[model samples]
Target: MDPDGDPARRVRGHGLGLVVAPVLRDYVVVDIETVPLVGTGPEQDIREIGACRVEVAPDGRHLVAERPFHRLVRSEMVSSVWGSGLSSPSAAAVDVADPDAGLITCQAALEGLAEFCAGRPVVAHNGRLHDFVVLDAACRRHGVPALHDDRLDSLDLAHIAAPRIGIELRPNADGSMPPASRSLDDLAAWFDVADPRRERHRAVPDAELTVLLIERMLKTIAGSEPVRQLQRQILQTGRNPWARFLEPPPADGSLLDCLEADTARMADSSGLSSDPTSRIGRRAVHEAGIHARAAVRLDEASVLAPLSPGGALVTGEGRAFRAQQREMAAAVLVALADGSQRESRSSTSSAGRLAVEAPTGTGKTLAYLVPAVACAQARRRPVVVATHSKVLQDQLLTDIETYRKSIGDIRCVLLKGIANYVSVGYLDAAIEAGPEGPIEALALAIMAGWATQTATGDWDDLSISQIEAAFPPVRELRTRLSVDELREFATDQADRLCFYRCALDGISTADIVVANHAVLVTLDRVVEEASHVIIDEGHNLEDGATSALTETAGSVALTALLDCVAHAVSGAGVLRRYAAACGASPPHERVDEAHDALVQCRRALTELGSHVVDYVRGRTEVTVAEAASFGVSYRLRPGLDTGRAEFARARRAARALADHLRRLSGCLALEPPMSALGTRHWRHIESELGGAAFWSAAERAGRGVAPRPRRCLQAAVCVPRASVVEPSEAGVGRYRDIGRGCR
Candidate 1:
């Protein structure tokens, strides 16, 4: 029999595609115990099957487990736990019951378990990840009904319900995270329930324990029916809500046409404008050479066609082509084209700004975006559209996709500062360090799950009120480390930056880069490539600019960076690892120099924070109560001498630490390595010490002129690498990932 033709094999193919599964009132709880089918492979033969049929009472007030099934199965093959370790019990533990309860055949056991399921949904503690996975593999080897039901995991429900109901997971005894070691044991301990069998986990007892825990969690959240959040997650087990980004490109044989997704894309690309009402308008643009892809010249009539009544946007796209929208778009189009020509003609020319004070319903966002996208495509340079607020940036991004789909493939991206992304390496560091408290634990667990599933690698979506109600650690996760950093870190380690989908370095060729004004204020080197700039909501620009331009060495930021530096130099840190990779440890005195400088920097930061606190206390005009009610504002006035000495001290200390770090990096980089992966690591450090994440003031050439720091965070650190990881393998020219994530 062809395995591909197997029905069970087909089911497992789409297992990860679960958007939802029906949640029935009654279900079967299954727990299976198995050992490797051989001395070496992943194939496992089930040694025991244990299950209980759970039923919700007619009134839906309680859960009941009535029919129970247990079997010690006979196997033709001798088995051991092998390298699987504690995940499976040894054969000795399996036979602890009387040495001869007389085992059943593999076929008999599977048939009996399927009968026990009796056509009900199956629930288990981490069933989808473990139990059924082994079962499916076993069934494939043996050729039998796999008994795969609508699989549900209690572990997912616990993660969701823990915070809402005030529950904390019992951190694992080995100090590792649960869910790898995720077990019925943790849930049983939390709910004060335990597996009933005397020796524990003889199968049926474990199933009973899971059923009880699920009941407790479900009932605790609400009445007999599970709370909607819990129910949604349980049904959609693998479909993490955070895993999604922009609407998925249409699927195969989609309803609209043959190979509809491709057809739609072709239609979108084939014309300068898809507006059916503007056929005559497009003909005129084509004659003006404006409808041609790169030959698209920015002209008023062609640019406004897609935004006016005759455009495709008025039909399937929800936008009604308003005359004012067209008028504004036309005005902006002419100004941008004229300015672009002027700038190309002379360096000092004023690429002027045009502002429109139009009514609220005039479709102002589309007005600017239309001209911007058209001009960018025409001029063959990225156009940057800066929104005054994050909300408007998001809204404008949506508007571009919605209304402007007819205008064409505007290869646009929402380019944000690196802080808006979470780094996978740092996330692993946080989990390995363990959360400081339960709220932190819950947030970490949710983040870990989101990292696996997210396409955008966007930061935590927690609302402001939600973040404030939680602890400070949630904010820490949000600010430090990003996916852009991992591309470099992983490159040196030769590890796949696989877990994150934040397409690292994807924005370089994007036709339009939508950014917030704060990003614009940084004068981001990437945004500097823009041929045209569109500033939306100019009314609020001054406030956003002033707030962004203000410099502050935040207590939170300073401490987080300090922690990363400390971790890199610790005894088990990257220094030791890098030294070993290079065939020798640094001289003890040299290593000591690095540690001593780090210590001084920490002391200086603490002193600086203390000085600023004291200075703000007496200098601010507003009272503390009023400040707390609104927000804290303190201006650092020069010559007023508030904390100036402390600031100078801290900067010097930081610079000293940086200097020592560079000397060590240069020492190690000069030493070559034995293996391909190690060679890659050494060359990365060897090349970038001039000014990587933790830098030395060693200079590097930018052109034959302007110098730029060759940035790198230590191979171990994740926070500041900001897409500036420089990898130089000999004869392969230096390339840097400016870390612009594109969707």
Candidate 2:
């Protein structure tokens, strides 16, 4: 049994290949350090390489009995690339005096690593983005074929297994913060893995630390068998075990299908059995219902009595709650659960709305959450908590877990927009397309592990940007899909349920749904589900709404639109894949025609964007000052006429581009015989068409071809604190606020 032979086998249940644990007991851990120099001409110089062989016992014990392979690579090749002298630090780190005499050459080091990793899974922390890439680059530079090993990123595994720790970003010299480091040293310290090394940057020590971290994480995951069982159940059943708590019940069987498909894919990959069972049993369900019922039975007098002035307040933990928090909770509970205070549905203020402001240390989240949960349980109506930031959402999720333990089993879920999740069908397609490079291969591996372990398909739990940086295609495949279409492609109930869970489908059924304000405004289903809404950081509402309503036809948008057309034309996207599967070819001539129109439109948009930027710069007399909310801003140049001609030209160009998009959408609509698989792609294309229509309408309105109603543009631009000066009496007013930034 070759553990690394089949990828499907490796990424099955718990992402640990539990079915083939015995065969996967032996593997090598590898790490590499590189000095990246300026210039793209082969400047990656490998300073060191490290490798360790380990064996695991069936009891989950592991040993690194073999002597580790550690080597310092010669840096003479690096000197050639950098022109003469190497950096002092680089020179000191290597045997530069007689570089090749004692040290291994890059080619030799890579070959050694390949031999060591051969027929065994190779593990490293962030190997996909850093170590593995560096090693592959070195191999390419030395004319060696890349190493073919079953690679597992311990970093990816750690995120799935260990407790999530907040990444603290390091402030730059300019007061901006650099992306936080998830380095081996930092993670080891986080996991409390001892490393007594005097210096931490060395390849060998880091590799050893990575192995230790992996062992620790594996042990922790193994110990949590019940959670794993629950996850497996979710996969097999295509239903969240706690879904029974949902009001009206989640009617969509599609969610279960989607979740089960994902589970089945994972199981098939790892040769694990995908057989469903009554393993969860009636006892677990009975206990959960009991807990939920008990949680909702709070005596109004008993709960509200302590919250009165001069009365001691207590939490579910028996600790004395803060007075301010208690008071706030009392007010919220009265508004929500108090029948006497509950207004008639037809009343102007019938909806329960309570605004509370307390200092930071007052435990505002818990204060509102306790009452909200109690109210929701009592009324059997879901509560939606709208947050302005991901930080608050995470904090709320943590607090919700605490409440669940102390109070009762409340089904709370975090809801984000579709863009945050990777589509299972798309991901599977991308992997099957056979990633052409090492980075892409690594991305596939990482995603495989993540798919099996992730409860919510949201990329928030993974290092998404890092993965995308390693392989750009991963980002490309993250296209949003409609819930109904996702269900169609979902192979089983598990896949369907997973999709529903992540895409905010059936979210209304949750006891408490935590969502961002952006989701509230854009995803109508979210707002429609809740009987009451709690907006945390309520003061940001105006700004959030402003952002939600704003639109900008900027360079980024144009480029992305062009890319979409290009993908469509080349028959290289999800739609094309589905079309192929259906034995259908899209109307190639029509697509080509649309593609040509988009190309011309893109050129025009580019020109228009530049003209708009120049017009803004020329009209503003004052120096362009950077505004925190509005980016760069300046007052109109004194005595300067508003650039009416420029505005008209830009508007014309935008309208033309929108027309081109609409034409392309029409072409896609004429698609040949499509199967159910093609439905998702068709829907996405339709969405794109809808966007084009919106832009066209907006452009027409801005150009005054459509009704201008209140002439709100002029009012907005003339405001005293407006970022840009008022438009002149000329028609420039119509196009002055052309590109409003939106969330």
Q: Which candidate number would show the highest lDDT if scored against the true structure?
A: 2
Off by over 4 Å in 2: 1-128, 132-202, 205-258, 261-301, 304-321, 339-353, 418-452, 480-498, 501-509, 521-531, 567-571, 574-587, 620-652, 674-743
- Summarize candidate 1's per-residue lDDT along 658-728 as a digit string, tens digits: 45434434433333445413333343333322223433212110111111112332321212111211111
CA RMSD for every model?
20.5, 12.3
Instruction: For each candidate in the order shown, give its overall lDDT on alpha carbons.
Output: 0.48, 0.51
Stretches > 4 Å off in candidate 1: 1-303, 310-321, 337-353, 378-380, 404-408, 418-509, 518-529, 539-551, 567-636, 641-743
> How far is 270's C-alpha from truth in model 1 (Å)?
19
